[model samples]
Target: MHIKTRLTILNFLEFFSWGAWLLSAGAYMSTTLGFTGVQIGSVYATLGIASIFMPPVIGIIADRWIPAEKLFGISHLLLAGLFVVLTSMTSFNSFYMVTFLVALVYMPTLALSNSISYYNLEKEGLDSVVTFPPIRVWGTVGFIIAAWLVDVLGLKVSHEQFYLAAAASVLLGGYSFSLPLIPIVKNTSRTLFQRFGLDAFVLFKNKNLAIFLVFSVLLGAALQITNIWGVPFLNDFSISYKDSFVVKHAVFLMSLSQVSEVLFILAIPFFLKRFGIKIVVLISMFAWVFRFGFFGVGSPEGMGLLFLITSMIIYGMAFDFYVISGSLYVDKMSDAKVRSSAQGLFMMMVNGFGAVLGAYISGFVVDYYTANNGIKDWASIWFICAVYALIIGVLFALVFRYKHTGEENLVIKK
Candidate 1:
């Protein structure tokens, strides 16, 4: 089989496994397990906490010793057992501990998957910037399919989602061994600081990378808010605008974001090739402002529907350009020895620190607007988020002044 085809399959199952539970698990805990809001937050916080540190630690191991594909397989194999345990846990304490362990095993695999993909693609003489976005789009498709399946099978609030994920995890675990090996890049003469992730920290010494990473954190906060709130905000219209199709089919409406994602993913190679990393990423930041801007103003009626649809459409550009391109930038910029760790650092900043901040600030925004009677002013909340994105865009444009040479993605410096 072609290497890209094989890797595409791998990417598909990787995200499909995640989509099975990540989105609907809260609904399950809330409705079926009878968990309160705080309890659910505590349980879900496990993922953010695990993302904070695990990726870099595992990346260090992959960089120094075991091949990345081997580590990827081992992580998923462990996840299979963890998910099984998670399926049976009934108490909040036990569930929290077990699910926390689940996150620990699962989170690192995200970085490993990229490391594996980039290494294998280079070995096969393919350019990741040219080839990867297309393959990566399949992962999103797999996620959409998984989410749809969970709903179709009536397992949204059931343990079956975990069960299905476990099955796929085990399959991917075994298949990972068949993938091309990603050799360990180690220096035997390194000092202890250089050996233990201080090396990855050196990436911050580069001014352009430093600025990019900072903005990545701020932009990362914007990334999850739409996914978290879009449906519920649309649901608010279900009563007042019962005749609106979007109100009645909010899940399907939200799915438009993922659909639009595929199109933008295809377009990324063109934009990145022509514009270089700086312009491409700046476009992403601008897209985010518009993404939230549309939401803040749009209603459920005729023109408002266009606003909502436009918001979902731009989601493709907001996420793919910011994240996928950022990963490509990291891959191109870092030393091969520290590549995995560098990718891990990117995951840590965006998914870890950025997400944690977004969660708290978004929660505060929601709570502050929540009337004593429990009503929320979502318009004001989204407007605040839009303003935040606008400020980030303006600051990014003014502050991050990188002129992307056509050679920015010049072959990885050996």
Candidate 2:
């Protein structure tokens, strides 16, 4: 097979593994297993907790001892077994523990897959910047397809999602071993701190970078709210709008967010050049307000349906602008030597600390809004999320300082 074809398949299965269970898991636990909001949130929080330290630790191992491809394969194989185990878990404690273990083994492969792709692309003498996006987009396609399959097969609330994910994990894990080898590079000069990317912590001395990172954590808290609740929120409508297409196809409707994500990514360079990163990021912050507000008011009927769709569309801007643009900003401002570690730090703040905060707090809000009948007040839940985003945006505008020159440009370097 051609190198691009091979790498595309790798990227496809990589996200397919995640999409199989991620968005739908909350609904599964809520509707099928009768778990509480906090319980569901705790389950999802495992991903954030594992993300906090596992990736960097795995990266160190991949760097100094094992090849990236081998490590990636090993991780996925373990994930496959864990997914099988996850299907049998019913109690909250058992489920949370297994899910956390699954996350610890699975989260690192995200970075490892990227490393494998970049290594192979460079080996083939391809410019990754130009070539990789097209390949990576297939990951999104895989995610969408997996979600659709789960929805159409009526497996969204079934343990079958884990089974499907396990099948994909096994396929990807085995295929990984056949990919081009990624030689481990042993750098003797690097100290333990540098090896673990702790050197990037020095960037905190800059007030602006420090503030940006802190807010990154705050905004990151918003990132998983939809993933953990969007399906459940939509699924709730089955009580009132049982025959409605949105309820019947909630995961499929939510998949539009990923579609919007692809389209919005194309617009980032233009927005970055015109408004610069600060304004662009500010636009993202407010977009989150609208994103959640729309969800707060939307329903399965008439104008409410439009609101729901609009929320999904806005998701693209809300996500890409903050994450992609913020990464670019970090890359541009940091010294080249610490640039990689700086990027790691940004992810740590957002996906690690931010995710953990969002998961638990949002779960609490969900539980708070639930009445004695166990019915959730989704509008209140979403309004609270919108208000949180609005406060973050306003505060960010007032406190975080960055002056954008008219000469701003978007240049993604390898």
Candidate 3:
């Protein structure tokens, strides 16, 4: 197989492992395990908790001593076992412990995947900036496929989704061994912190980077809210009206967001170049307003479903433009030695600290607004999120400034 093809397969399995459960896990928690919103939110925060330091720590190891491929394999193997253990635990506290352990293993793989991809691409003499987005899009496709499969197979509310994910994890773990070996060349001259992408913090000395990091954290906090709440939000619509069509297939409907993700992912190069990060990200933020507003105001009936559908459509832009474009921006600014760590730090901010904050706060909001029957006051929740995004968007526009030279225009054409 071509190296690109092999990497594409790797990318697919990489995301498939997460997609099998991440989105639908809420349904399983709420409907099957009878977990409250706060409880489920706490469970989801495990990803954030693990991410706070693990990525950078593992990244330091990968940058210096361990080969990226080997570490990637071991993480997956550990996570597969954890997922199996998670499936066996029936109680909330036990499940939380198991899931947190799984996240400790699983979260680091995200950074490792990027590191391995960059390392292998360099070896193959490929342009990572040009090549990676297309490769990464397949990961979203895999995620979409997993959502569809879970919805269609009626696995969203069952333990089988974790089993399916675990199977994929095992496959991915074993397959990672077959990829080209990445060298372990440590930077002997550097201090301990420098090896961990901590050196990239120097960028914070620049006003633009400092502002970028702050907004990125704010936006990242906003980012996970939909994924954490979207499925359950839609599922609640069904509970209010048991015979409702939307109730029977809430997961499939929610899967539309992932479907839209593939299209937006392909559009990133075009959008990022023409509009630049400011406008492109602004569009994404505004899209989030619509995303939340629609959910808040619309229902499963009448024109409400239209609002729901539109919200899902805009999610493609909301997710892709912010994350993919922000990553590329970091790439443009950082040095090669610390690039992987910088990326991990970015994730730590958005996925780690941001996610933890979002999960905890969202749980409080849901618990405050929801009825005993588990029917949520979704409008209030989404409205609050929309306001939060709007504030961030305005702050980013007013505070974060950069000139979009034609450099990235040339980049996208590749």
Best candidate according to TM-score: 3
Clashes (backbone N, CA, C under 3 Å), per candidate, total 0, 0, 0
lDDT of each: 0.81, 0.83, 0.81
Model 2 regions lying over 4 Å from their true place: 1-6, 115-132, 180-183, 190-192, 195-197, 328-343, 403-414
TM-score of each: 0.91, 0.89, 0.94
Candidate whose lDDT is highest:
2
Evaluated at residue 272, the lDDT of candidate 3 is: 72
Error of 1 at 49 (Å): 2.2
- Name every residue pair that clashes in candidate 1: none
lDDT per residue, candidate 3, 1-414, as tens digits? 778888888889999899999989988998899898889999999888888888877876776777778888888888788887777777899988998998888888887787777667777899676777788888888888888899899998988889888988999999999988877656765676654446766667767777887777777778888888888887787656777767778778887888898888888878777768778888887788888888898788889888889988989989888888787776666666765676777777777888898888999998999888656788999999899888888888898787887465321110
Error (Å) of candidate 3 at residue 69 is 1.7
lDDT of 3: 0.81
Q: What lDDT is obtained when candidate 1 is compared to the true structure?
A: 0.81
Q: Which ten residues in a row are the worst by lDDT in model 2?
A: 405-414
Residue 299 alpha-carbon offset, candidate 3, angstroms: 1.7
Q: What lDDT tens digits, residue by residue, belong to model 2 across residues 15-75? A: 8999999889998999899899999999898888887877666766676577778888988
- Model 1: CA > 4 A from native: 29-44, 88-95, 157-159, 236-249, 298-301, 409-414
Candidate with better TM-score, 2 vs 3? 3
Model 1, span 111-197: residue lDDT tens: 888888888888899988899999999988887787777766767668878988898899999999999877786567468987675
